[model samples]
Each structure stands twice: as C-alpha cells, then as structure tokens.
Target: MHKFHKSIFREYDIRGVVNETLYPTDAYHIGRRYGTLVDSRLGGKKICVGYDGRLSSPALAAELIRGLKDSGMDVVELGLGPTPMVYYSVFELDADGGIMITGSHNPPSHNGFKIMLGKDSLFGAEIAGLEKITEYKEGFGSVTKLNIKTRYIMRLLQDCIIEDGYKIGWDPGNGASGEIVQKLCKALPGKHFLINEKIDGKFPAHHPDPTIPENLEQLAELVSKNKLDVGFAFDGDGDRLGIIDEKGDIIWGDQLLAILAQEVLAENPGATIIADVKSSRLFEEEVSRLGGKPLIWKTGHSLIKTKMKEMQAPLAGEMSAHIFFADKYYGFDDGIYAALRFLNIMQNSGKTASELLRALPRYYSSLEYRIPCKESDKLKIISDLKNALKVKKASFSDIDGVRVNYEDSWWLLRASNTGNYLVARFEAKTEKKLAELEATLSGFLAEYGYFLEV
Candidate 1:
C-alpha cells in the first residue's frame, strides 16, 4: 500500500523527478484525489486527460486516467499534445476539468501535473487542497479515448486566413509540439521550414524554450537563410512562445507584447493591458501612447490569469511569453494561437515584420540572468538583499520581487516561481547608466557571497 505524501504537492502544481519522487502509484493516487476534488466542486463526472512528448508522459497519463476512472469520473484521454491542446479539449468536449502531464520547460528528468478546474487554473491553496483528499482516496470512474487534436488543428486553421505562398520558419525544440505541427500546418497558408521537428524528450536540438537567446540560434539561422517572414519556437509543453522576425531579431516577450498590443488596441481602444513586473517599461509607455491602460502585477501564470479576470483586462503577457488574450479568444496561454495572431497582425497592417517593429522607440536591455541558489536558501538571499538595499535615498517596488528605481535606470530581482533561481533584469537610458546599476547590485550581492552574472 502506497501513501500519499504532502511534500510532492506544491504551490503552483505537482512536480518531481521521474521514477525517484514520482511514480505510477503516486500518480494514480493523485488522479483519484484530483478526481474527487473535481467531483466535489463541479459535480461533473467527466475529465479530459492529456500529456506531453516525454517518454514517461504516456504512462503517467495512463495511470492518471486509471485513477480518475476508478474514482467514478469519466476520463477522456487525448493522448500526447501541448498543454493548450488539452485546454481546448476540456472546453470543446465540456469536460468537468482537465489534467496535463507535462514538465513544462523544466529539466528532462522532471515531470509534473498541471490541473484545471471548471475552466480556471487551480493554484495556491487550491493545489495544496489535493492532499486533504488523498488521505482518504477511493473515488474512481470511467475511461474513454478521443482524438481531439484533429478538431483542434482544423479550428486553428479555420480561425485564420494564412498566406499559403509565404515561407515561415518553425522551431519545435523536440517537444510535444512536433507531434502535431505538421498536421496543424495543413490549415496554415505558408511553407514551414522546421528546425528540431522531432519529438525527443532528451531535447537533442536544445531545450524547447525559446525565451533564452541561445535557444533562438537555429531558428534565427533558418529565418535569415531562407528569407522567411517570421520564426516561432515552442517551449517544452508549447504553452509559451518565442518569436524571431524576418531580420532574425529575437524579440523579447515584452517586445512581442508591444507588437500584439498594436493589433489589440486597433480593435478595442482604451482597453487595459496587463504585464508582469519583469516586463519592459517600454511596454507600459506604449500602452498609454496607444490609448490603453497599463497594469503591472506579479509574474506567475495563475496569478496573471486571476488578475486578468479581476481587472477584466483584454490582454496580458509575461516575460516568459505566456500570453493571455481575453480580447477574442480564450484567455489562456496558447502559443500556437499567439503565433497565428502575430501573422494576422502582420497581414492587417500590410507592414513587413521588421518595419512594424522599427516603428517602436529603441532601447537596449540585458537578458534575464539567473542567479542559482539552493532551494532552501533562495528566499533568505532575497530577504537579505532587500534589507541591505532599502535606504532613504533609493526607491523600490515589491510587486513580485524588488525593483530598484534609479533616476536613469532600474534593476529587478525576483525569485522564479517554478524553479530555485533568482531572475534579474536591468535596463538604462545609456550603457553607462546600466553599468552603474549593475555595479551597485554586484557590490550588494558580493557581500552576501553571490554576485550578479550575465
């Protein structure tokens, strides 16, 4: 007999290293517990289950379904696909809730569960509540199969009028996205020059995440070599987007937010735009210049979604490329949908991608440099830095992390929600100003035995 442990259930979702802390028995228990959670809240007996491209995902999803079925909740297995595909199935099929077996952009050895309830992301106390049900788990239900990916592909294709003659570049990054990119492209009106199109959990082509500049190399090459219009890359589970322009410029998420913001404002003037605290300050400025309200809040996806609903914002995005669009589509992070929306924007403007971006005022910034710390010490390090930097002369904001605002530059240090790392970004009006900000923070960090590194 296996007993459910409390340590595995975490703040955002359930995660652990495969075969070490995570196992089929544990997954079965989680499914039962989660199924019971569903039964209590929604009273619907059906749940849509899905997974990613990892070798363990299929087995984990199967065991998860077994538990759900055992708990008397009807299980609709959608097999391997991106997280957004699972969300689409849950909504289209009218599932009570859904659980996606994906590690997201985590390391290869890690796997986790992302659960959705009644069309909302479950997190914080809601995610923690799973343990209470696991203590006395018994409810299990019926299981079935549905090839919903075809419907999903057709829907994406139908939603847009793509240019069939255009040559576009794609970097799937060997994640779950490759499994369906070709199928979905049939509806797309362009030729795809794909890089890392194979679905390999080992991530031989580079990590699936496109947010990092290094990961954009291959896709950038393809864009320049073939003279493609645009390039797009998917994260491990394909919820986040990474975009490269025809000029091979690796657009930051905030920059992309600005690009999409142009299209969004054209449709609805004076709408609210929400972005994470780590986002570029330029985004907020542009929002105002374009006649939209800008709101900066915390960084997590769950938090952003909740804030979006609370503020009734039409569009939201994070530095990680998790875009939520309540403007015309479901307000969830769908990288594929985001990519198409980018194209739609380009088509409407009749502007080349580079020309569109060139319209924005230029500013230089550093990549989000991660400072590694032990899981136990990360929080303390933040606290120490916060106390040390708090002075009568300095202005700071703590929306998520500490954002020190100087006269000519700013630096933000926030702990990552999904990993044991500190995310830092610095920007300035000039190279000299940026160096001053970096030097100041570097001194503070050095005293604590950790220094900022690019």
Candidate 2:
C-alpha cells in the first residue's frame, strides 16, 4: 500500500500544512519514489537536497535523505538556504537532480518540496506518477555534506554591475533568504538596510508573501524613513521578489518586468519576452513596442521556465514575481538574483525607480481576486464559463485560461492550478468600463454558484 496525501501534489510543487497533510513519512516516501524514478529511468545516481528555514524542514529533510540513500541515490546535502541556492547547487555540483524542501510563500505552518531533475521542474503528471510506483528499491548510498553558501553568494554577485553609492532597503520576511541577504548587503558597495534578516521559520515580522501589499509594509516603511533609493522583499523561500520604490510606492510584478524588459530588449532586440496571462496588457504592449515579441502563457514558475527555453527567450516573468533570466544566468526564478539585476539596470539608467516606472503609460487594473470553489467544481465552472462565452461569440484566448479581449481592455478568468479557487483580473480604459466588466464576470459566476468579492 503506497498511499499519500494527494492534495500535497500541486501543479508546480508539493506543499501542505506541516505535520498534518505533510509528515516525515511523506517526505521519506517522496524521496523513495523520486529516487527510484531517477535511478531506474533517468539513469541518475547523485542528487542534491536543500531545505528552507521552516520549523519542520530539518526533520523532513533528514527523512527524505534517508529514503534517497536507501534507494541507492548518493545524496549531496546542501544544508539550510533559499530555494534558488539549491537550484544553483544542482548546476554547480553537476548533480543529476535536486529537491528543495521549502514552503515557498506559504504560511509558517506549511512545508513542502520543489523538485528538479537535470534542470527540469517536476509537476503535473510527473509529480502524480510518484504515487503510483509501489516498488521501493533499497540499497546503501552515500551522503556528503557540502557548505555551498560562500560559493552561492559569489556566483550571485558575479554579474552585479552597480554604481558606487546608492542606499536601498531589503526585507527577507524572516524566511530562508535572510542570511544570504545579510551577506549580500555586506558585499555590495552601497548603504544597505535590511529587516527580518534572521532565518526564523516562524516568520515573526509578518507573512513572507511579497505579492500581497500588506506584507510589504515593513519594507515600505523602511524605504520611507531612510529616504532610500528603493526596497525589495522576498517570499518565504526567496524565489520571488516584491519591490517598493524610493517614494514608498509599490511596483507590482508586471511593472517590474516591464522595466527590466526595456533594458534586456535594448541589448537583444527582437527577443521573445514571456509573461503570464494574469499580467497587464500594458506590459505585453510594452514588449512589442520595445522591439521584442511578447508572449502570455500560463501562470506557474515551472511552466514559464519551460516556455522560456522553448522560445529561447532571454527573459520572462509572472504577476506572482517569478522572474526568469536567460540573458546572463540560468533560467530559474531567483529573487536575490533578480534584485541584483534590477539594481544594475537602475545604476546604468541613472534614473530613479519612480521615473522609470511612471514613464510607462498607465492603465487601470484589478488585483487578483479569488472566488471560493470546491477543487472538483473549479475546473467545471471554468469549462461552463468557456462554453457560455463561446455561445456568445466572445473574442478570447484560452491558452491557459479564458482571457476575453475587449475593445479597450481585457479580462482573465482562470482556475488556480495550485489551489481550489477561481482567480480573476480585469483591466479597462476607464472605471466605468471596469465596473461593467466586473458585473459581466459576476453574472457568469452567479450561474455557477459563486460570486466575485472584488
């Protein structure tokens, strides 16, 4: 009997509330199954493992390592660090695959694994297959402890090109990236202010999600009080970034992507730049105007990275702040690396963050609004809604979700791949049009026993 909590296996990664949905036993099984797949099919023997600052991470990692070793997969334990460091470890050590034990932006009570095999992220059907494999092959495999912190930091700072003096603020939200952020601040040539730099799994200051406005409050306050040039915040695992400007203005993920795109497109014209369907149309248009091809794809880090490689795109980002850069670095989402790249862009431009973002044409848009729905019902609602739109002869793109294109704006309604919720966002030329679209979406939702709250 090889039973496991099915809910933990999401579209992107495995995540669950610690000790409840996820247990040490689950980690062991995951390692056993994943290791078997690697050894039997992928023909890989060496694997790298790393964990975040979450309370249960250490125990989970230990069990996972034991299982991996038992399955005859040599384990390279990378110890405590952000998720990206683990990604880097795989590449640096030339390991066959890597597994990062991180909850990502989830709450402190949550913990899980983000997996990679030979530069490929495992999700969807690949993750699901782990449950079906009942055979657990046992053998004695070696475990090696490696301190990769110094090497990781040096690699991150390698491409950093910043002008001598500029003050900036940073908040790690007491997540896994704290120690690295502290070290990075010391190495850089500028006045660096940081908060919540201690790697406390409890996340004592606030929740680690930077996508939510409230979580950026501490960084915003610090930027304002110190009259700093800008501020950056990281999610729980440090794979995503949240930025605030010198004036304490929140620069949403798309806006940050747009800014970065300008610089990247300048160097490599006609390059394809990808963004998630949840991003602003303005960003897509900006990419086109900057002599680059803009592609709107599904919202997931794994999906985006895969697309980036396929399109040979130099850059790609999502509204959730998972920015991938193949311009100078590997195509992986690393908030710390993105921050350094952004700083380099700012330094070269010799302009304030406000000036850079404000110059872009403004469009009124709504934040991601979630409508509660049962997991089973969520996709069915979307399917029904798609049918309704088709009957009405609506112009929309169903690439990932249904993004209906209007004359002056667009609206997107997509079932969340990671959870049991329908995520929506709308944009229009004016508030009146926005209101009308909201009503239109609400009408569709009402028929499915759901309502839009925003």
Candidate 3:
C-alpha cells in the first residue's frame, strides 16, 4: 500500500509544491490508483497524458506513466502541450480518461494534475476517493505516442468566422500555449503581434496568470505601441483568458462575457447563458435585454461546464476568464477559442472593443480578494458568516457561498475550493454603499476571528 499526502488531493485537482508536498512517488500512486479505478469501469483502459512546460513535469510524467502501466492501464502520451490539448486528446483519441501534468496559473515551483474519467471531470469527492484504494491489480497495458496538435489547431479554426482586417496583439506568457499561439497567429487573419512565444518554465517574462492586471502590462504595451485593435493573454495552461481593448485598457472577464453575449444572442435568441457568482449583475441584465436566459452559478471551470450541460446552456463563463461554448464546439473552457470568437464578433459588428463595451451598464466594484485562513477553518468561517447573515435576516443566496443582496449593493463571501483562503467581492451603485458593504463584510469576518483587508 502506497501512502499519499492528504494536502495534494485538492477539491478540483491534485496540486502541491514540487518535491516538497508533492513528489514523483505521489504522482505514481495517483496514476496507479486512478488507472485501477478507470480500468474497472472501461473494457479498454487507454488513458492520455500531457504535461506543461514545468521544470519538474517531465520527470513527474515519466514516473506517473510507469505507475499507470503497472496498475494495468494503457497510456497515450501527448508529449508537451496545454491542458486543453490533453482534454482534446481524450476526445480525439477516444481514450477512457486523461490527465494533464500542469501547475495551471500557479508559480513555477508548484505543479499538479488535472484529471478526467471518460468525459467527466474528476473533482471534489472524486479526487478524494483516489486515496482510499488499498487494492492493486496489475494487467498488461500498452504505451503509445499521439500528437494531436495539428488536428487540434485545425479544429480550433473549423468554427472560426474570421471576417475583417484588424491589428491584434497576442501574449501566451511563455506558458504551455506559447508555441500553439505562434501556430495559430500564422493561420488567422489580421496583423498579429505575438509575445512570450517560447515556452519557459521559469516564466522569465511574468507570472503566467492573466487574471492579475499587472500580468497583462506587456500585452497592453504591445497594443499601444503597435496601434492594435485588441490584445489577448492566456494563463499558464491556456484554459483561462485576458483581453485588452484598443486603448490598451483591460477588458475584465465580466465585460468580455457581456460583449460575447451580444454576439451570441443576435444569432440565437433566447439561448441560455451562464456566469459565475462573482460576475457583475449588469452582465445578467444585459443578457436578459438581449433575449437570453441568464444564470449565475458557482465558480470553478468544472462546475460551470457541468452546469452548462445540465441547463443546455450554449455559452457560459466565469469572472476568472474560463469561457465555455457549446454553440459551435465542444463545451469546454478554451482560451484560444474564446479569443477567436471575440475576434469574430469584432469583425462582424465592425465595432471597436471599447465601443462594444460602452453599451453595457457599469458599477463600482472591488478587486477579488483572497484572505488567509487555514484549510480546516475556511469552511467554518464561511459557515459562521452565513449563520450571522441568517440571524440578521439578510437577503442572500447560498448556492455556492453567501451572496448577500442589498438595496444598492451586493457582496459575496465564499471559501475557495482550490486553496486555503476566503474569496470575496463587493459591488455597488455608489461609493458609499460600496464602503458600507465592505464594512459589513469586515464585521462578519471579525466575528469569526478572521480579518479581511478591503
């Protein structure tokens, strides 16, 4: 029996700092356990594996592959590519399951595995179940190399409606998508300026997370210097995206979603659209105004994708830039595909990115804040905050967290599923109500012996 570190098995994925909390041994056990589980469910146990450009990934992947073969599962290796490419490989190769060795947007020192069983995302309790296995059955399984990047790129271009000539800047942040972006830019129309096209594990350019405004500075400058019509940025693994307008100003996830909604609704009226709880209320209003059904769901790429399938949503997005489209493609979060769709809207409408956004209503909002709290205490803190809100008889929705609705403002407090922290946001029509909401949230956290730096 192989022992596994409890911390490495997170709610969404298996993640930890390399060589410390997570090691090659942990990866091997994970592969062994997951392989055994999948082998029992499928007549054929062919699993596809891919890794990002991390310093430790190649070694970890080798060890994981050995364990998979030992546990009786055939392996289809997709050498090196983004996490989404691995997901595509599962579909392209018709494998029983897939695993992507990636750190996502985490720092270079951290790494993890994103898993899928068949087409279902392995998360939450399913990820935790890997640790309880005490039996190991070995069978003869094969290993093969499958490179689907050419086919994947073709698929990305299949549904793209490239219309007009516009200068665009693209930044891959030297993550796994770097080389793919180079290939994509060469095929797509327009004057494309590419940056960070070399995959470097150290991320010598900047942290590969596009959600942070600071990370987009390089792309923004490129847009300004080149007089580009728009700019696009991708997170480390290429499942998340960031956009910059013509003026070099950042177009946040909510605003980008709203703009894309306009294009989608124009073609398919009354289609259902989904967004996470952290999205702006104005985005929902805009969707309704465009004759689409708007839904607010929990934050997490896997959770959003599952909800989209359940509701038959043609489109869905999170405030963190995880956009899913079932309209003309597989319902999965793909940053490059989303960027292409945004280009289609711009070309078809003949409108600037800034002009398209000016049509939507705006509100005063706070940057997403992550406050430190022990993993053991985060859920309790959220529970205590919810109890306090209930006692106050506050109007709120507890679907994922406590999203309290006030007369002129709203605030959300939720425990992060991926990390040991409480995530929060506040929005209001006026600065006064914004401050009041912040104060109110601060008071609730104080009651739980935790403090939020608003």
Worst 10 residues of 2 by lDDT: 1-10
Error of model 2, residue 233, in angstroms: 0.1
Tell me the whole-model lDDT of each prediction, alpha carbons only: 0.83, 0.91, 0.89
| TM-score quality measure for candidate 1 | 0.95
Least lDDT summed over 10 consecutive residues: which range in candidate 1? 132-141
Per-prediction TM-score to the true structure, in the order listed: 0.95, 0.98, 0.97
RMSD of candidates 1 onward, in order: 1.8, 1.0, 1.3
Q: What value does the lDDT take at residue 407 in candidate 2?
A: 79
lDDT of 3 by residue, 354-392 (tens): 888787887898989898888888888778778877898
Model 1 stretches with alpha carbons more than 4 Å out = 1-7, 134-137, 388-390
Over 117-155, each residue of candidate 1 has an lDDT whose tens digit, in order, gives 978888989988776663533564677888888888876
Question: Clash totals for all models, in order?
Answer: 12, 0, 0
Decide which is better by lDDT, 2 or 3. Answer: 2
